[model samples]
Target: MAVYTQVSAEALAAFLSRYDVGDLVSAKGIAEGVENSNYLVDTTRDRFILTLYEKRVAAGDLPFFMALLDHLAGKGLPVPPAVKDRDDREIQQLEGRPACLIRFLPGVSLSQPTPAQALAAGCALGGVHAAVADFEPTRANSMGIAQWRPLLERCGRDMDAIRTGLFDRVAAALDAVERDWPRDLPVGAIHADLFPDNVLMLGDEVTGLIDFYFACTDIRAYDVAVMHTSWTFNARGLNPSAGVGAALLDGYDRSFGLSAAERAALPVLARGACIRFLLSRAWDWLNTPADALVMRKDPLAYLARLDWYVANERAFA
Candidate 1:
């Protein structure tokens, strides 16, 4: 939701002209994402999400991510379909912004999901995995553990005053994760950022998933762990109740069951999962400009998760 790219009103209207979408009726910043500048665009004909990707989203990788979403939707996965433009392109320049148009899927985001809704998000994730596992295009793991090493190296200073600082424990946990991470449970493509904001639902059933910026070739369970980070946590960002984790785990297990070894690995993966988010939150905290519309998602939440892992380390790692 950060307005990184400065787009004037006139410039936005001009970008709309390239598409079949007639006459931009109204356009305003749909500032709800940290990675992209989004405008909920209205035209005489319909409503659309116009995304002006931030630097975090590499321009080269847009096609693969866009195609993957379309592939999943075509297979009946609940998600928005990328709108191909007049030049038969999925992405176009909007106000000097490297942007793309997408058909908005209908639904409410499951902020306070029911057991049914939480469970469905789990099921929908599995369905999406089924739909996307074999899609051939590939991209770098933008938010993966491997990618975190450099950031952690640069930003891994002291945070000992904090009750939930993971800076000390994470170094050791990361080593174990790197060494023992599952090599062959099932690997293909996965929606790496299946957070609540990215998932849309109508009532208890899911409608679609957005924000494939983090999708990549990775271990399936790791993706599950990544998703579990958001859905499994409460407003305070700890597990809301044990039942939340159990429910989400149950729903995911229904789709992609885990083995005894995989189950043994789940805690560590979940810990790894926490660190992954902790690092990203730390990065955003350190880097976000004050006026940025995007609120920095809390790093302390993940740090608290790390402390939770250290205290109750047995269940997961």
Candidate 2:
């Protein structure tokens, strides 16, 4: 939002020139995310998303992420097919950063989406899980147990005091989670951050999904967890989103029915997803350099969701 991945017109032009589409008529920033500088490039041929990768996404993993999109697209899942260069490499260096261009998905992000659309997003995400199940691409999760555990370890010695009255059970949650969290239900690639903002809606239907940076091999239920966080939680931190969750779950069930184990783990996976984002936001806030244009997302947002989890811990059907 703050030009975190700044790209000048000259640089953008050069990036576009390498592709089949020629003559960038106009390039303007498209705002539906806090990370990555995304621009809608109107070319003489067609429109496309020109993304200048940011620090949050490491370039090394771009291949697997891009391939996953290709994989899903082949499966008839609603996803943007990553355009390849003449050399067939999914990623190329540009503007001193690893960059990519994807065909612009035709849809807009909805704020007051209908119940049908919410369910559609959920089901579509589930479709992704089904499509990519046993998907053997590459790229391990950048934020998995190994990464998450140490962050929790550092949070020991009263790091909870840093945020103050925030996420009191975070430590305990992590401990019990490591010991008891469902690990064997089903594991595969997940859109680990499938927030509403990351998905596009077209007339009460999910038309396209964006942001594969967080995609990786993990528990399938965690994907459901991330969706619940987005569609079911609000900024003030309330769980009035259950109806949305029901529609989502319904849609997901229609696509690929969850196992009994996955259903049982959904609430806990949702809680883990909540805390994962919560800790990431807090860490990013605390670690961001002073001059960075990237304004860290409010850690309070996730903390509120955590509270919502505690209040409705066993409320899900």
Candidate 3:
């Protein structure tokens, strides 16, 4: 949802000509997220999201994402699929990048979600897991456990620039996570990045689960752990919301129950989640161009969550 590349009005209109979506009325760049160039496009017919893949999103993986979205939509999940053109093509070339025109889903992404909303999001996530149980396509989690240390190394000494002693803390956390990460757990297609902004809600119901760019085949419980860390924490990552966390897990369990082993692994899986984001953010913080139209997130936020998980391991137990 960032604009690394600018698309001119003329070029955009020309791109729209390939589709049956009607004449473009207006297109505005979206600057919230750190991946892909996104535009809120409106036409005579309706609105659609125009996304130009950028950064970590590989062009080779586009089909997997498209298939996953279509699969989820087919199973009644509130996921937006890429809109095909006159030639029935879902993927297209726009602004010298592989792009897609997605159906714009209704609902605002909540900044401060209530417990009820949290519960609904949990249920929606559980439903996604259930829906994808038989999904054959698999994409490896690029940011999974194995990539943590290498990502940190890529960050190098610049890590301490974000915070003193950040490097050692993240390195040590990585060691512990690598040692304790579970070998065998239920695996399936997971929305690896289930941050609150990724889930669209109308009232207490989840209207959409957007952003399948980071979706991959990974531990089912790891997805829960990622959601737990993202949803249960404040924006600043300073405080935990117990009621929201409890309700989220309860809702998920009610919809798609977790095995006893998965429950036992949550604490460790949570630590891995923390490390994953911590390193990626650190890398993005150091490397993302200053002029990019996206907010650079703080790596220390996840470091704080890592500390919380280390001290309160029993919270997940």
Q: Compared with the true structure, what per-residue lDDT tens digits does model 1 show for residues 226-292? A: 7666776764576555655667767877986656666676766777888888777777777778876
Cα lDDT of candidate 1 equals 0.75
Highest lDDT among the candidates is held by which one?
A: 3
Q: Model 2, stretches more than 4 Å misplaced?
A: 30-32, 152-162, 167-169, 289-295
Candidate 1 TM-score, C-alpha based:
0.91
Candidate 2, residue 297: how far the Cα is off, in Å: 2.1
Give the residue spans of candidate 1 off by over 4 A.
158-166, 313-317
Q: Which lDDT values do the candidates have, in the order given?
A: 0.75, 0.75, 0.91
- Which is better, 2 or 3, measured by lDDT? 3
Score residue 215 of candidate 2 by CA lDDT.
Answer: 88
Give a tens-digit lDDT track for model 2, residues 63-158: 788889888989987788767877776687776878788888888876555678888897888788788865788567788765766775555534
Clashing pairs in 1: 1-32, 1-33, 78-208, 79-208, 267-316, 267-317, 268-316, 268-317
Clashing pairs in 2: none
How well does candidate 2 match the true structure in TM-score terms? 0.90
lDDT of 1 at 154: 61
